[model samples]
Target chain A: SAVISQKPSRDICQRGTSLTIQCQVDSQVTMMFWYRQQPGQSLTLIATANQGSEATYESGFVIDKFPISRPNLTFSTLTVSNMSPEDSSIYLCSVERSINTGELFFGEGSRLTVL
Target chain B: DQQVKQNSPSLSVQEGRISILNCDYTNSMFDYFLWYKKYPAEGPTFLISISSIKDKNEDGRFTVFLNKSAKHLSLHIVPSQPGDSAVYFCAASKERDGNNRLAFGKGNQVVVIP
Candidate 1:
């Protein structure tokens, strides 16, 4: 199991502003992922953040809207750009312990509310 | 289309009894399934998982049963405790090119009364 932490557990932001959420892991992990969970809905994968390369965005998400930065193996950040009321949701970061096993550990999650 | 589905939105069970949570998937490509439990204001914690090759896996008070042909899986908790009350999520993934991505279903809220 991994100990993951996210900053700004809850926040309220004005529309058109951007919020950056940080994820820090206790140990180094190979793959890091970002997901969005709408209220009373299932989670949707936003992107896969690579340590030294650009993040891979999912089908419905684009980098322009959710820019990701992974400076190292134990840390990554996801920025919600140009926030709108519809963009309000809980953002979570997860990491796979090993490639052979598909177990994922997640952070506490950052809840963002746009006004 | 929702690849993973948890038909029941909520369930109530008495403490010290068995609690069962059900999930179904529409994608046959899913070769791995996992169950996660979450409390309000907290991230989900991994509970149990089963591979496509296995029909069942158990861990202490929790057991996961998988039926590949029916594309269904279930989580069972024995001697349920009030602390076990939380939202449970079912996730499925397909191994492709050495990489795996998960598809999650809407969670089911379980309330256990003592």
Candidate 2:
């Protein structure tokens, strides 16, 4: 299993403000995933970050709204731009532990609250 | 359009009893199913998994049963213990697709009574 760590385990922010969440993996991985879990909701993938290339955003998610940076294999950052109340959720980073099984190891998650 | 669904939001069971949680999926492409356990303020940890080729997979006290025809799967905890209380998430993915993507359910909260 891979060890993933995220900054700002929890945060409180005002509407219209932007916050950047950083994710660091203990080892290098080819790809890292970003997911959001809203209150009482399932985990939704925001984007897939690949090293040395642009991040791929999922449907209903855009680069302008959630800019992602994958500077290296072991590190990535996700920025929430002009966040609104609806953006309040727990953001998590994960890495695939096995390609055959598609098992993922997740970070502790960063809980964000917007006012 | 949630691909994975856990119809039950919560469940309570007495110690030494069996705790069963069910999940259904809408995507036939999903051939690999997994269950994750999450404690408060922590990320989900993989508990068990079953590939489409097999209908059941068992670990120490946890067992996962998969039904490819119905696109449904379940996790059973034998002799449930208080430490087993946590939110369980059902996730699915296509092993051959090579997409490395997993669709997860909302999660089921389980409580084990003493």
Candidate 3:
């Protein structure tokens, strides 16, 4: 199992301001991902943070809105740009422990509230 | 489209009883299925998982059963304890394009009463 840590566990941001969330893993991992969880909703994958390349965004999400950076295998950051009330959600970082088992370990999410 | 669905929003069980959470998926291509437990203000913790080829996998108090033909899977917790109360999520993934992207289901909140 991999241990992950996310910064700014909870934050309140003014509308139109951008906030960046950092994710750090205790060990190097190949597959790192970002996910969002709205109030009373299931987790939704925002993007896959590639170590040395651009992130792969999911449908309905764009890099312009949620920019992601993966400088190395152990660290990644997700930025929510031009935030709106709709952007207020719990953002989580996860790492795949093994591709064969397809099990993921998640960090404590960063809860965002836009006013 | 929700590839995975957990129809029940909540479930309650008495301590020491069996807690069963069910999940269904429309995508048969999903080769891996997983169950996660989450507490408020925290990220989900992996509970157990089963491969599409296997029908059942057990981990001490937690067990996962998959019915590939029905495209459904379930998690069973025996001797449920109050500490087991939390939101449970089911996730499915298919290996495609070298990426195994997970599809999550709406969670089911389980409350274990003492």
Candidate 4:
């Protein structure tokens, strides 16, 4: 099991502003992922962040709207650009301990509210 | 389309009884399934998982049963306690692609009472 943490557990921002959420893992991981959970809905994968590489984003999400930065193996950040009311959701970061186990550990999640 | 589905939004079980949470998937290509438990304002913690080759996997008091033919799976927690009350999520992944990416269902809120 991995100990994951996210900064800015809860934040309120005005429309047109951007919010960046950070994820830190206690140990190095192979793959890191970002997801969004709308209120009363299932989670949607936003992107896959690999160290020293550009993030691979899923459909309906782009780097322009959601820029990701992975400076090293144990840390990554996801920034919601030009935020709108619809951007309000709980953002979660997850990492796979190893390629063999196929299990994921998630951060506590960053809840963002846009006004 | 929702590849993974947890039909029940919430379940209530008495303390010391068995609590069963069910999940179904529409994708037959998915070969691995996992269950995660989450508390308020906390990240999901991995509970149990089953591979496509196996029908049942147990860990401690938690057991996961998988029925590939029916595309269904369930998580059972015996001797449920009040602290067991939390949201449970069911996730699936394909054996190929390294089984890293997962598709999750809408969670089911389980409330255990004394």
Candidate 5:
């Protein structure tokens, strides 16, 4: 298991503004994933961040809107640009422990609310 | 398409009883399945997992049963406690791609009453 932390545990932002959420892991991991959980909905993968490579965005998500940075294996950041009410959701960062089982360890999410 | 599905939105069980949470998936390609427990304002924590090769896996009071043929899996918590009350999520992933992307189901909120 890994200890993961996220900054801005909860935030209120104005529409059209941008907010960046930072994720830090205790141990270096190969693949890091970003997900969004809307109220009462299942999580949706936003992107996959790998060190020293471009972040892979999932369908319906674009890098222009949610730019991700993975400068190192232990750290990654997700920025929500030009925020809207729809962008208000819990953003989570996770890393897979084993490829064989696909078990994941997640960070306490950054909850964003756009006004 | 929703690859993973948890039909129950909420479940209430008495302490010391069995708490059964069911999940169904439409994708047969998934080889690994996991169950996660989440608390409000916190991230989900991995509870247990089962592989396609195994029918059941148990850890302490938690057990996971996988039925590959039916595309269904379930988590059984024996002697459920109030501390077990939380939202439980089921996730599935295929291992061939090495992508490790998990398809999650709508979580089930479990309330264990004393």
Candidate 6:
């Protein structure tokens, strides 16, 4: 497990607004991921934050809706654009704990409530 | 479509008793199975994992059992403690797929009472 920190642990946003969540890791890592868990739902992978390149999004997620930026290996950000009530969920940042096993260490998630 | 299924949404156990969580997967491509635990207002944390080549892996009080033929897996926690109460998630993936993407299932909330 790595020392990971996220900003805006909890927030309430209005519909049609946008919010950006920041994830900071203690050490430089090659792979950083973003995951979202909706109410009563499982965690879904939003994208993989690749350093020095555009993030790779999952099938159901689009880069326009969820823009990601990885300026450096130790820092990354996920922006939820044009949010709606249905977009309320807990977003998390995780780093690969072990590449061989694909184990991840997650930070406390950022909980969003869109009204 | 949900590839992984955890039938029971919740489980309750007494202290010092055993807590069992079951998980089933429909995708045969998933060869690596993992269990994660989450507390309220926190992200899910890695617990234990088993490879397709192995049937069982034990770590301290937590043990994971895998039955590849049946596409079923289980997590057993012996001598359950109150601190063990949390939501446990079942996740599967193909390690060598190059991408570390994982499919997660609805977590099971386990309450340990003394």
- The candidate scoring highest on TM-score is 6
Q: Against the unseen true structure, what C-alpha lDDT does each candidate score?
A: 0.91, 0.93, 0.91, 0.92, 0.93, 0.93
Runs off by more than 4 Å, candidate 5: none
Worst 10 residues of 2 chain A by lDDT: A95-104
Between prediction 3 and prediction 6, which has the larger DockQ? 6
Task: List candidate 2 stretches off by more than 4 Å.
Answer: none
How does model 1 score on DockQ? 0.64
CAPRI class of candidate 5: medium
**lDDT at A49 for candidate 3?**
96
What tens digits encode model 5's per-residue C-alpha lDDT throughout B6-100? Answer: 99799999999999999999998999899999998899998998889999999999999999999999999998999999999999988885536
Supply the global lDDT for candidate 2: 0.93
lDDT of 4 by residue, A36-102 (tens): 9988888888999999889999889999999999999999999999999999999999998557455
lDDT of 1 by residue, B1-114 (tens): 899999889999999999999999999988989998999989988899999999999999999999999999999999899999999999998876233478999999999999
> For all candidates listed, what's the TM-score of chain B alone?
0.96, 0.96, 0.96, 0.98, 0.97, 0.97
Q: Positional deviation of B104 in candidate 6, in angstroms?
A: 0.7
Measure candidate 6: CA RMSD: 0.9
TM-score for each of the candidates: 0.97, 0.97, 0.96, 0.97, 0.96, 0.98
Backbone clash numbers for all candidates listed: 0, 0, 0, 0, 0, 0
lDDT of 2 at A51: 98
Ten residues in a row with the worst lDDT in model 4 chain B? B94-103
Model 6 bad stretches (over 4 Å) = none
Model 5 C-alpha lDDT versus the unseen true structure: 0.93
**Can you write out model 6's per-residue Cα lDDT over A19-102, one digit (the tens) per residue?**
999999999999899999999988899999999989999899999999999999999999999999999999999998888465
lDDT of 3 at B60: 95
lDDT of each residue in A15-95, candidate 2, tens digit only: 999999999999999989999999999998899999999999888999999999999999999999999999999999999
